[model samples]
Target: MCSLAADLATLFVAFALANLLVIGKFVGEPAKPHGLVMFAMIAPVYALLAIQAGVYGIRSLAAVRETILRACWAFAQAVMLMLVIVYFGKIAEQLSRLTFVVGVGFSLCGLILLRPVMARLIPRMIGEMPAIAVVIVDSVPFTAPTGTVLLDARVLGIDPVRHDAEMAARLASAVGHAERVIVACPSERINDWSIALKSLEARGEILVPELMRFAPAKLDEYDHHPTLVVAGGPLQYRDRIIKRLFDVLVAGIATLLLSPVLLLTALAVKLTSPGPILFRQQRLGRDARLFSIYKFRTMRSDMTDHAAAQLTQRSDPRVTRVGAFLRRTSIDELPQILNVLKGDMSIVGPRPHAPAARAADKLYWEVDDRYWERHCIKPGITGLAQVRGHRGATNAHQDLIDRLQSDLEYVTNWSVWRDLRIVFATLRVLVHDKAY
Candidate 1:
């Protein structure tokens, strides 16, 4: 995604440079014709390159490698096409090849260089972007102290504590001067937190938990205290039922539609390798229920058990040539549609890990309690994690954490539109080698 942004920025810079040169030549009494005409001629080619490269709609941070490759490919293709048009149209003499080459080269280099510099400088930039006032309260001084340590550096403006009524009044005054106010405090002191929360809540203030420090487990540990008995129950049975129904409907339809591809994949697996057409393995499902998930066999039958659980790195000995291709394009996962049809999976949810994959188990369990909450929904053939480039391997602890976060985000913001968006995103990733 950053690469795509770089490509667009490069294109914009190229157009801007061309326009500036043209304007200087024309308006400053030089030899050039209309400035606007030159600007129009260059801008359309840049826009075309951006569109072909899929740069315009890229998110700020996602699959960087694929985005860069796509940008480079699109730029190369655009340059070649532009050169052909200019040469054949008898305008080659009018356009300076040195100037064109320098413009393109400089623009690409500038775009590629700007992203890392901007990323490094973003913390400093946020202060200049927008400002918000935040107040923190806690019964334990250490708890509030920890809050300051965990505070987001991106947030700007004042932070006033509950201990000072004078600062609290100043905070109130600053609230109107600021764009927004955030309150972070311990869930244990509900009455005290509530009195403060209610006053803020009454004033239409937004409240967010300092989840990084005092997680749900810590909050639940203090829930029994008399002062912290704020009321809220688990998810309603009706809502759970509705979610299950939707999952079944979507998974069922997907299985039926993709049956042909699944069949062809099975045949290909059987023909290319001397092994079971489908690889079935035990995986922890919803609520830690054990279920067998299916996939087209991509590895040889002689692949070691340890290697099966471990990640298949690039150019691994176990992966057959066909297996490598299948893995790269994710055709190996097509058989999981059967699991979805059998009610063992959903069309979109958390990607299930093999029960024997101890590496995955250790990393996933290290996170906040809500890490396991992903199991509350059925496992999926394609999930937010898979779409976001979190699938295939568990080399880093952060990867598992990111996957769990995406899974939880999908659950919290569950909607038909969100599900469709996830499906489209998954398709976009699948069309290219975003994952292994």
Candidate 2:
């Protein structure tokens, strides 16, 4: 909060100095309101970019060099964005270009000067620093650095195999108030531990030998021991923010634009079916967390499978007459827009599956170990697999593999543009032959 306040104050000062002295006095011209408009546009952009760059984070308190660099980087990007907006809006003639350049220069200088002072002052004012390091011992031999909170996974009843709300809560409680959480477990449990830690509000690492066959995003040494960063919840913090913003914006607009369709679909399901209008089923979401997914009811109430233990089949008798058309047109999945707005899912990501969902009579995770890694990000209503026509029944082992391959591919190489592309591509496959 202190950093944010100081940075805002600096920007205001820079704007005042540039407009009052540089433009009004030196240029001998009436100061136009256009400069103020530009300032308004740039301030929020700077804040968002600054947050993404970690300029107002804990690192700013400990590393002065990084703090200045990140602040400058954010400021530079904000100015560039403002220029783009001005250019596209064709309002460049409304104000003097010199004012924009001078204001940006002053703000850049102010940020560089302000960060070092805040770095030294914040700690003294906040009293004792909070715990920033934690180590979890999960039946593995390890040593922790000095002054770290250490907890035993067994004692806490934390089992990664039981990936449910109760276990997630236990893990979160054990890792409270720590900025970094490291888990030491047997090599066989590395993937399990990674999935378990993905939902926590902290950085997670696993202690493993350097020779382990794991492809980690980063590897750091702790007390001369190797620690692999296996779970960086949402990959990058900036990407998480960007993806979430995209989800909310698209989902919110979609709901507003498609309200009539949603209402008609709800009415159709209610009037045609004997049960409820919407069906809620438990499915695995991001970080292997379980969430109830919403969808228009497409099966007989007595035949509805909340656990998704039975996969839908072609010409299934359990499906109602109205349900078959809904399924065939992919209208049954429209209720999941609420799930996206509720933050349980994304607009584009690996599709979530039920805990007991299986292929070739084998559970998905049992068929392929890499399946667990797909939970690193939130599941989506439509995804790479869906658009690629890898939908419907997973009757064969290779069926699961094909979808899994597309899902992992999406997870490994994600971008906002790719998500947009997938969303557009989805429009072409809504009435696909394999939808049922």
Instruction: List candidate 2 segments past 4 Å from native.
Output: 1-36, 39-52, 56-65, 80-91, 96-134, 140-143, 159-181, 186-204, 208-219, 228-234
Pairs with backbone N, CA or C atoms under 3 Å apart (clashes), candidate 1: none
- Please give the lDDT score at residue 391 for candidate 2: 93
RMSD list, candidates in order = 19.4, 5.7
Whole-model lDDT values for every prediction: 0.54, 0.81
lDDT of 1 by residue, 310-400 (tens): 7667677877777777788888887777787677887777787664453444534443334445654567888887788876676766667
* Tens digits of per-residue lDDT for model 2, 92-205: 887777777888889989999998798778889987666677889989777676776789999999998865555765676677646678888998998788877766546788
Best by TM-score: 2
Alpha carbon lDDT at 224, candidate 2 = 59
